[model samples]
Target: MAVVIRTANWHSERSAIRSIRDAVFVREQKVPADLEWDTLEESARHFLVFKDGEAIGTGRLTADGKIGRLALIKSARGLGYGAKLLETICEHAQTLGHQRVYLHAQQQAQGFYSRAGFIVKGDIFSEANIPHIRMVRDLDFSSG
Candidate 1:
């Protein structure tokens, strides 16, 4: 399947973006509703992954270089949407003068992030009751 990923407007696309995240995070992962939805959504840069015009995955990058709330539907897992979303967010961060992009990767997803150039930075911790590890990827802008 050919999937398209683009920067999202949280205001205009909130429902669509929320649907994907809610399904993956809240519904499936059992994340608390209060913790899953936060004020940062208004200020962060979000990305939505679409397959056949349906929102199937989403992620966000905050101004301070933190990438969070990355989620993809079960059918889309292992199909490259996750990596594509991460790459897009990291590239956007690079253009915004950020040297590195970091994220709290879920324990099971650590390998996925590692393959995308992120290295673990700290010991495991719990977020929304799920084990997570801090990972960081330095953007190499020397070529540009």
Candidate 2:
């Protein structure tokens, strides 16, 4: 399918990143614009997923090891691209000396993160009027 994942920053890939996020988080999920757009974009490392040379998904990892803003266009779901985006972000976090990575996963997507070795750490909380739970995964540094 010629899938590719590329590392990017806000200044370099803002439009592509925002397009996917807007489709998945804002337009599809109906999340508020104010809550979805944050100051973290300036510092967080971003990952963009492309299939057949077309941008389809994106995610970001913060300096503090928080992974968030993961979004995939509706047409791109269930094709395994999400997993690639997540693994890429986790690998980057490990390379940055992070011991673990955490994310506030939407309640329904908890199972998705769980399959990737994340475990729930706390009670469900509300964000942007959607239920979410904190999921964390420890990075294994011995492999690389």
Candidate 3:
């Protein structure tokens, strides 16, 4: 099972990205429409994952060089797509010369982010009516 992670601007791939976000964040988790989207979307790098030529998942890297909106479809979970998405985001970050990357991860998914090399920091917070926490990853590979 090979996972392909690619990034494109909103206009080039808005529909596929929207479908993933809506399925994971809106209809599945009941995240309100207002909270599910933000101004960053327009300028962010939206990544999509395709398996066997079918769009399977998506995540976004913000204009300010942040990665947070990572949501894969339910059926796609546990298949390594999530980690591949994170890898894609980090690669984009490197291309933009951002060494520090952070995300507001939903509390329940903290372990997932942790396994992807994000270190949990600070206390829990709320986003879209769900508990979340701040996580950061330093991409300065030369240090370690």
Candidate 4:
């Protein structure tokens, strides 16, 4: 299926982004309500992936260009949406003068991040009852 990935700002896309993250991270993955919902929401630039005009996945890019809270509903996994979202965020970060993009990736999703050019820089740790690792991808847009 064809999907459209777009950068989402505050006000217009918050609800859709929240609902998608709530379903994937909070409901399915059992992430604590506190971690699933945080102050970052208001300060971050969100990305929403739509299929047929439906919000199926969402992620965020922080003001400092850190990427986090990546969540994609079960129905949309493995379709390259996650990577697309990350690429979009990283590209935006490049435009914003960010040198790197970081994320605390769940252990199970480490490989996914790795495939997207992220390198694990630290040992695994627990967050919201799930094992996570600090990953970073340096964005060098100077050549382009």
Higher-lDDT candidate among 1 and 3? 1
The reply for model 4, stretches above 4 Å from the true place, is 141-144
Error of 2 at 8 (Å): 1.3
- Clash tally, candidates in order: 0, 0, 0, 0
Query: Please, what is the whole-model Cα lDDT of each candidate in the order they appear?
Result: 0.92, 0.91, 0.84, 0.86
- How would you order the candidates by lDDT, starting with the best? 1, 2, 4, 3
The TM-scores of all predictions, comma-separated, are 0.95, 0.96, 0.93, 0.93
In the range 109-141, model 1's lDDT, one tens digit per residue, is 999999999999989999999999999999995
**Each model's Cα RMSD:** 1.3, 1.3, 1.5, 1.5
Name the Cα RMSD for model 1. 1.3
State the displacement of the C-alpha of residue 27, model 3, in Å, after optimal TM-score superposition. 0.5
- The runs of at least 3 residues in candidate 1 whose Cα sits more than 4 Å from the true structure, single-residue gaps closed, are 141-144
Q: Please provide, for model 2 over 4-86, each residue's C-alpha lDDT reduced to its tens digit, 9 standing for 90 to 100.
A: 99897789779999999998899989999998999888888989998898989999998899999998888889988898889
At residue 38, candidate 4 shows an lDDT of: 83
lDDT of 3 by residue, 1-144 (tens): 666778866887888888888988999999998888888888787888988777888888886667877887888899777887898888789889998899988999999989878998899987789998999998866665
Which is the leading candidate under TM-score?
2
Q: On a 0 to 100 scale, what is the lDDT of residue 84 in model 1?
A: 87
- Span of ten consecutive residues with least summed lDDT in model 3: 1-10
